[model samples]
Target: MIRTERIDLEPAFVLHSRRYRETSLLIEAFGHDSGRLAVVARGALRPKSRMRGLLQPFIPLLISWRGRGELATLTAAEAQGEIVPTQGSATLIGFYVNELLLHFLHRHDPEPDLFETYRRTLQRIALEEDPEPSLRIFEKRLLQATGYALQLEREAKSGARIVPDARYIYRPDSGPEPWDPRRHSGAGISGETLLALSEERLSKRDTLREAKQLMRRVIFAHSGEKTLISRNLWRRRRSSDAA
Candidate 1:
């Protein structure tokens, strides 16, 4: 006889959750070993249910579940520790991370390292004044985890190490090619910026801006026509501020 797989007290975070039936809930949770999985939170909506408080997004949780099919039954859940209070833009960025994972990661595929990266990113988001660096790093890592990382270290055709002074056009499929100066304005990236990003450095304004643009383009290409709703909202908010 085969035994059903049961996960007990696994480290996880709720990505999204919705009402299921009258009192239960359907939760999309990201588990350290399970990647992403669908879970049913039975009777979580009842007034006295303890799971109700523990099932929220942005909170670190230890959850127990058992299942043999697509949706697992959530047997227990509790806070691993105190939530590091993500509010304002941090919360939005948190949602953005969730949506990205939901869009790219396959269900039940284990990504333990990426899961740790995500947990760190969330922790930083709660404390950082500027959340872009965290978001960008997570975005790049997400692409890499899903097999679409941009080549930022060297020229694609010449195979030469990227010079810090040279300019380049980031081609999605082919990587960064040296850009022609006479043909275009200073819209392409500077080698210094690319190198900075390669080293996970985002202090300078120019480096941050260029890296954001490049990463956004790569994400859009792989997104398969799905508009990142949070990204659109962010742009609109920026545009309105400018206006």
Candidate 2:
């Protein structure tokens, strides 16, 4: 007899969903213990299907699936909590967060702490006026969990504590080092911004800006050629508002 795997009521979120064939749907889900997985939700697109409304992003869900190999069959899904109130730009920010996870996390790798971070970040984005801090912090944590942890509090080579007033070049993979005119080509960040990020107290206007730039550079450097659609949408929104 062949073996099979079955998961029941695993805490998860729907990262994405697309129509499969005529009535079924292909779903990408991120579970607290299961990491990222793909499942086929048979007949989920039908008018009377219970999952049509339940399988949406930013909604806390209890998902069940069964099968063998990379793709599984979705057996059941239920709401674990109320839908996250992500309106206006917060919705776009939530997508950006999901994109980051899709880009950084490998399938089948269990990251319970990162899952908690993702959940908390969504809650923070829904509640906070400035969602940048939450995004930056989430990016930082994701990087750490994926093994590219930022070296924020100390000099990369000299090993000295970061000075709040000094300007440094933040190298992807290598952390921050003293700026050198000809040697440094990485993102320029202030020591204060680095410190604020290290402490997870990113609130000040300047700190937020610097943190945004630093995280973007680092994420793109590691994520390779994949362009984040959510980020592009953000740029377009900013451009439209300016015009």
Candidate 3:
């Protein structure tokens, strides 16, 4: 006889949660070994449910669950330890990270490496580190693990190595191609920026800014036509900060 797989006290982080029915919650959790999962935390909405406090984004949790359906039933949950608090821009950045996983990751797909990266990114953000670099690195890793790797190291047209002195435009389907100065009006970037991104070396402020624009375009093109709510909210916060 085959035994059903049951998880008990797994390390996880709540990515997002919503009210389900009258006294429960529909939770999207990122497990260390199980990747992304959707769970129903029964009675979690009650006035004194322990799960109510534990099921929060950016906090490390120890969660127990069972069953083999698309949505598992959460049995128990508790905070693993104290988590550093985030405020202002860091809070928005945390939400953005959660949204990225909820929107892009598929159910039941096991990605242990990505899970570790997520944990580290959150910790970094909580420490008030610059979120841009961490976000960029996570986005690149997510894309690569999900088979949407951006070919930034070479030219798409002639299979030649990208030269730092030239300029190029990144096409979602075809990687980067030489930028035609006379034809294109916008969306092209310097080869130096692309190279910097490929090397994961965004130390220069100009390179980081250019790389942000390029990745935004690439992510938008590949994410189809659906508007990313988190990205929009992030932009609004950024605008408010500027103002």
Candidate 4:
């Protein structure tokens, strides 16, 4: 008897891609069941290849691939449904989400929770809602799922309940620490901000700012030394929008 590889039509989103040889592409995709996978799209760079357009980021897709190595061969790909196109800041934010997954998530790791968060985040972005809140929520969930859960409800050192009026510093490894006035000037955040984050309320401007700082520190610690291009572009866009 001969053994044959199975081809699956899985719901997926493109996380990242790079040119493979001259006329093909290597794509990293996140699927509902198969999780993150690297698939090679042969002749994808050809002008007539339908895969060229179907593999873009933020679009839901039904993809069929074969083989079972670290990299699979793309057999067929099709757009799943109507995608509301995003532009301006929304578009950049979508790319930023993709970049985060591409950089942080391990290939072949199945994270259904993360997948659901990504889908919802894209939908929120498509509707032109405040991307910051949605992005931050997803970021928090992603960090939690990946074992870097942010302990916002208690003190890191004492494991005591967080005081809503006191100031605390978030230690990446140990959770929240009571702020020392003389040693650390800026790391300490209001307890109210921590409480707001615990409640997922991004409407408070101060809390949002502090949450951004905390998340940036956590992401930087885990993402190694390479900088995300999408983050740079998003920063430029934000500055231009402010001006």
TM per model? Answer: 0.93, 0.95, 0.93, 0.91
The order by descending lDDT is: 2, 1, 3, 4
The list of candidate 2 runs beyond 4 A from truth reads 181-187
After superposing candidate 4, which stretches have Cα over 4 Å from the reference?
1-7, 241-243
Clashes of 2: 0
lDDT of 4 at 64: 92
Measured by TM-score, the strongest candidate is: 2
lDDT, residue 213, model 4: 85
Q: Cα RMSD (Å) per model?
A: 1.8, 1.6, 1.9, 2.2
Error of 2 at 46 (Å): 1.4
lDDT of 3: 0.85
lDDT of 2 by residue, 53-161 (tens): 7888999999999998899999999999788999888998999998888888888899989999999999999999777888898999999999889999999898999
lDDT of each: 0.89, 0.91, 0.85, 0.84
Span of ten consecutive residues with least summed lDDT in model 2: 179-188
Query: Candidate 1 residues 6-58, lDDT tens each?
Result: 99999999999999999999999999999899999999999999987779898
In model 1, the worst 10-residue window by lDDT is: 84-93
Candidate 1 global CA lDDT score: 0.89
Candidate 4 lDDT by residue in tens digits, 1-243: 544355677889988888989999899999987788889999988999988877888889989988766878999999888774778778888888888887778877899878988998998887856677788888888888777788889888788999888998887777888899898877588788787877788887778888888888878887885688998997888788899
Error of 4 at 67 (Å): 1.5
What is the clash count for each candidate, in the order shown? Answer: 0, 0, 0, 1
